[model samples]
Target chain A: MQQDAARLKVTHEGDIVQVEFTSRKILDEANIAEIGDQLSALVEAEHRPRLVISFAGVDHLSSAALGTLITINNKVKNRDGQLRLCNINPQIFEVFLITKLNTLFHIYPTIKEALESLRSGAQTGRLQ
Target chain B: MRPVFARVVTGTLMKHLKLQAGSRGRRESREKSVGLWCSEEFPSQMAEGRRVEEKILSQCRKYAYGQRDLFALKLALEEAICNAIRHGNKSTPNKHVRVKYRITRERIDVMVEDEGSGFDPAVLPDPTADQNLERACGRGVLLMRAYMNNVVFNSVGNSVMLTKFNESYSSSDTPINSTTVAFG
Candidate 1:
């Protein structure tokens, strides 16, 4: 399955950190339902300005993905950090539009844009 | 052709024909019946029911004839099926939940049956109240009633049958399509 090859890579650059959770479709909600608590613990430990969600591997998303993203963002904000999504595939983007969640959080075409915006302090609620 | 290969080819062709014929019959039957039927084993063959629900939504949304009505049906069906899995059977493997869907000219019908002991449907706490909104739980059953045109609990809460009506069907006489399914 696509999720079997998925990875959540964690890397840091001097107080700047990027943690990405990559997954495929069947891994969508069941993954969140299973790992949400683990994500909560991880968010509680980090203090950073940006979190990147590489949607390169995702096939489809649903209300569960939206809810999970929102919950994680809340957890990050509690730690004074923000969540950014990057490399969103077309199928998942369609869902984002359908749900009108494109308005909820920062999104970028690539990780470079996300990091650059964060460093430049273009602080905003959500970017299309 | 090799005997085994020939058999395999014939078998696959027959299966494809059966499925194609089944699809046609199902479409024709649904014109009047508007019902979905399958065995409890269907869930085990698949991972979860929500994905199935979404597929059904996309397939049947046009039949709903209105976006809001479509959305309501989607939400109500999700809650009903989720409850059938979570609350009714508590997601227990030992228990089987059977779902049957039917839509008449006016009303949509969904019947959910679980193998577990029944409960009182009346005692569910209201999730819309101020105190319950943020808890992230307890809203499934209430939302079912909110979106469905009607809700009925059988002799016990082990089974629930939900119904919704299209306003058009009520105002004008709707012709029921009469067809029996053929799968050969």
Candidate 2:
């Protein structure tokens, strides 16, 4: 499993791959690269395209992490897979709003919500 | 009559010492401004930028800065430092990037300097524009300005200074309620 190679907790709900973060602080440079690489590798796995990265354990992340997310999103799209994120801290949530990345990614309020939405294949505008 | 003269001399010296003590007090306040600095050599193999960001965030938290303000400071500091290493120094191990910050009760100020020749901040394309929306590289400068209260570039553009004001902080020898901060 790609999650075995990095600091992510990989779970599965039907076809959805839930990658929960295990770190309280994801702002470290090496950790950012590790998470990005792990997620990127997951995206390349055959027959496993849908992803939901849970940020419940993460208090905050660096801007380089943001760039990593963007790169991973691009890679997922190229593979015809979808990626979603959820459980972001309020401070990090504000960062997403500031960078307009909220528009670029499907951000749910919780892991359950993200899984449910992705499972239902519903495209909703959660950003306002 | 001699005793009176001695008393007068003693009073004069005490007054002069008080004056000197007052000036010293003023200088002490100036010195009380807290500062942190880090330097990274070019061609650095590690992501030192992330570690620096974490350090700034920890300092802000220790000072009881509001969560929103801390987030802004974190974003601005990270962008500035990374820009120094990646763009200004061009990741050349031969050059270097230096970061410094001063935090007071009223505000926090930071500076990031790089060894490379600077570019004009005005000439950079607007990252928020439609054509630039898909691009990943240009948002660092934009985020720094958006999150910081003040962003100033030095002549030649090799360095930047960022400042943010705080309404909830009080810098005193005895802080009344420093533990009551909301960290979000």
In the range A22-112, model 1's lDDT, one tens digit per residue, is: 5565234466665566556557767554566667666644444456676777777777887777777765575455444566667888888
lDDT of 1 by residue, B1-184 (tens): 1111101123444454345445555555434443333322233212456655655556455555455556566666666666667677777765555665544444555566766688887887764555543334565566566667777777777877766665544433333322222111
Give the C-alpha lDDT of model 2: 0.69
lDDT of each: 0.57, 0.69
What is the TM-score of model 1 when looking only at chain B?
A: 0.63
Stretches off by above 4 angstroms in model 1 are: A1-7, A26-30, A97-100, A125-128, B1-36, B41-83, B87-89, B92-95, B101-184
| lDDT, residue A3, candidate 1 | 23
Q: List the residue pairs that clash in candidate 2.
A: B42-B92, B42-B93, B43-B92, B43-B93
Query: TM-scores, in order shown?
Result: 0.51, 0.75
Instruction: Please give me the total number of clashing residue pairs in predicted model 2.
Output: 4
In TM-score terms, which candidate is top?
2
- Give model 1's share of reference contacts: 0.00
Which whole-number lDDT from 0 to 100 does residue A121 have in model 1? 70
* Interface root-mean-square deviation (Å) of every model: 6.3, 2.1
lDDT of 2 by residue, A1-128 (tens): 33354588887666778898888877666788788888887788835499888889687776778888888888887887788888887878877877778878899888878888777886753542
Positional deviation of residue A85's Cα in model 1 after best superposition, in angstroms: 1.7
